[model samples]
Target: MISSEYCRLMARYSTWQNTSLVNAADGLTNSDRWKDRGAFFQSIAATLNHIYWADALMLERLKGNGRPEETIKHSLASPSNWDDFKVLRTQRNEEIEEWAARLVDADLNGTVVWYPGDGSTRMERPTALCAVELFNHESHHRGQVHAMLTAAGAEPEPTDLSLVP
Candidate 1:
């Protein structure tokens, strides 16, 4: 089982990395941020939107708040405006920080039942496992955003976990 400390650390690290990415992105023009760079999400804006959407979805599941009516693909199209995306991203990061601070060891031990956004099908997994998946998913997509940022001449801060403060 993952420890509460681990979850807390990942939460903080995610917030730091995300802030850095957003600040770097803000320095660029909309055209640069939205340019298709051939990544999975195609552009920096789309990739960042996807991350925000996934975070909200997973957070809802972790909290047993039930799934939203929209599918993942539909949600990924959110924060469509650059200014709105920055605001929503910051808000979500704060929400994750607060949620992590309240997590206890027991909270991570039991099974988490959630609708996987594929019609009526439901999936179950250990809470710790799901938490790790959420964090890992952020890193996986942030790497793509980081690459896209660099390709667009925006230098995001280093994302080494040990270097997070």
Candidate 2:
């Protein structure tokens, strides 16, 4: 259902889109970014935090490098400030890119077992599926952030994957 090439493309696209969104948010004042816009996550900052949180969770599952407990802990907590968020976000993007660069067919075809962070049970699924999920998840939350950015009068760069350079 997925391939390394596909994963690589999506990874690059995800990084590109994320950078664009973060840059757009950079234009807003701290108060404006954190203001309650009545969105699902209540604010642009919260929504972006959620995306970063999920990215860390899924990346750990995919890469098996980070401690799940620690990743989940930080993700559940909001960044101390925008600078912290951007730093972490940039670091995670680089990690994702590195992982995608080294990915292989076998890696994508393999399965990963993990607790769904609910503490109720564990689930297993193909790495490819999880990889796709990561990209899909980012795009989903980014859509909300994009709307919020526009609503806040900040013009974000275009989001089309084909436009990535």
Provide the overall lDDT of each model, using Cα atoms, as 2-decimal numbers: 0.87, 0.87
TM-score of decoy 1: 0.93
lDDT by residue (1-165, candidate 1, tens digit) is 688899999999999999999999999989888888999989898899889988988887788755543544565656768898988999999999998999998999888777665648878888889899989999999999998888888899999999999
Candidate 2 lDDT over 1-165, as tens digits, reads: 888888888888988888898999999999999999999999999999999888888888888643475556745778959999999899889888888999888888878778764556777888888899999999999999999999999988898988977
Q: How displaced is residue 165 in candidate 2, in Å?
A: 0.8
TM-score of candidate 2 relative to the true fold: 0.92
Runs in model 2 deviating more than 4 A are 65-67, 70-75, 118-120
TM-score of each predicted structure versus truth: 0.93, 0.92
